[model samples]
Target: MNTRQSRLDVLHSLRERETRSGYGWALSTDVPPGLQQSLQTAAAQGLVELADREIRAELSAHEGRPVLWAARLSPQGHDVLTYLDASPDPTPNCTPPSADEQVIELRPAQMDALRVYANLGPVLRVAPADGLVERVRTAYFDRPGNRWRMTLTTEQIDSVAYAFYLRALSGSVAEANWFARKYGVTYRVDPATGRPGAVRPRARTVSP
Candidate 1:
């Protein structure tokens, strides 16, 4: 059996015995060393606690050695088992954004706003303007030859919108909208449900 299955069996065994605050497993003399090692790992991951054997029968007959031989689920381990036993929800239907869907040209301040917002999610805060500019420069614009690319690509815009979406979803809409309006951008509203959708840049006015 795979290591995962073996570990799972160990956990189930503990459950079957309703192992509480005492020496848990008294393995047979034939149990493999690999499964014993697996138990050690499970203990390390906060899944189970292994205790030294309390009885002579719990010691390995062949090795004539005391076994580190008891198991009980930790609080985290119990939570994992509970989640695994629960009914799972169906997968949601979702479509990825197209390559050039609603591309927006960013002004300098708008770009900084996006950079700061993306750096911290749902925090309702921004770094200093200069600091944000330095970060954006270091991350995307700065080149090996000390050159910089001023224009933002569709991919960059998509990333900004996605980050904004996460922030808005986390209940920071008011703060997000304030920044959006300040930067001449708006969080897209879903026409069907009239909820905030994606972040989009405003069209530049052509002054005659």
Candidate 2:
């Protein structure tokens, strides 16, 4: 079994208990040895916390290590689990996106007008391609400031496109417009109307 997979299972079990009992979940001593490492790794990832209490004194005495009793999912952990569970396949590849590609995958249904506070601070809310969500989340949560910099990829574009830098706050979108034009991508803003851009078919006049 994959260590990360086991860790997620453990978290799910604990989370279930918390949901039913209205209390924090504790680690059971009956846990498999293979899961011990996974538990530690989860804790390191801030997904779970280890308790210092001595619930399994006998095991600690026999194993020459302190028994970890309490463990509960952190807020971020909950969000991550929710995100992962919603995926078609929960097993994540966890591969980092290429630095060269800089386009966000937009849902094919409609390219809605998106607003960003700053020219560089826009975050696309659409679903990313396979294995890309986790990487984006990690980079986003790990960093400070409203400025998020990473390569955005979309199914609409080819694989070789590079990533772009985004900033926060809304003002003159000249930079955004320029970037969109530079890459031959469409922006929701119309230069003439100074409003949300829309696609309209060519006007046809009826015979007089």
Candidate 3:
């Protein structure tokens, strides 16, 4: 018999062991009992992801039925863990950063909630541009040597969009075209759908 580990414990362990962009620990290998359940629960809530032997969960989703025996912290899980370690920040000014137009629009208070997902997920950073104030670009690193790549899941992206009263999917051409009109927002066509959307480069990652 094995003791049941709390969800927090499992998440912590996962993050410590597998925080990289493309790695996973096999749940069936040396993981504790009930870990698979915990992982599944987290996955259902957009925390951990259950993948096949190779950790190619995304490809399996498009290819066929997946084996899903490996597990790792999802982008949201990383963000959740990261958020727990930090205090809530009040610097968003109730507006999401418009850099790169990649991260989903974060509400004033909720904006800082998921910054961990994409290494601060487009949090507004101010800098000097030719002696003038300027907005920091998404994935911009303070040091050129600190770049560590990371990416968010489509579910994570869509969730943020929907949370801000927008949708990643446009049902009609008119709706797609109208996306550009929101708050003076510009539209970009998602390569997967070729439909206009309010965000772009949905697969880019950020790391500190």
lDDT of 3 by residue, 1-208 (tens): 2433366677887776554423454434445657667778878988887775455565455446553466777788878778766633323333443442333332323333223222333453511112111221222332344431112234344433332332223233332233334323334556778874446434557886
Best by lDDT: 1
* Backbone N/Cα/C clashes per model: 0, 19, 1
For residue 7, what is the lDDT in candidate 2?
Answer: 70
Best of the two (1, 3) by TM-score: 3
User: Which residue pairs collide in model 3, if any?
Assistant: 150-205
Q: Which is the leading candidate under TM-score?
A: 2
Query: Model 2 segments beyond 4 Å from truth?
Result: 1-10, 17-22, 54-68, 82-199, 203-208
Off by over 4 Å in 3: 1-5, 19-22, 53-68, 88-208
- What are the lDDT scores of the predictions, listed in order? 0.51, 0.47, 0.46
- Of the pair 2 and 3, which is ahead by lDDT? 2
- lDDT tens digits, residues 1-208, model 2? 8977777796786577546533354445544565556666888988876655553564466547665564567887788789877654423334566665553432211111122211122354432344344334433211233332334554323211112112112333444444455555443545677874322233689999
* Candidate 1 clash pair list: none
lDDT per residue for candidate 1 within 24-99, as digits (tens), equals 4434333356655765788897887654445444435433665445456677777767765652322311333355
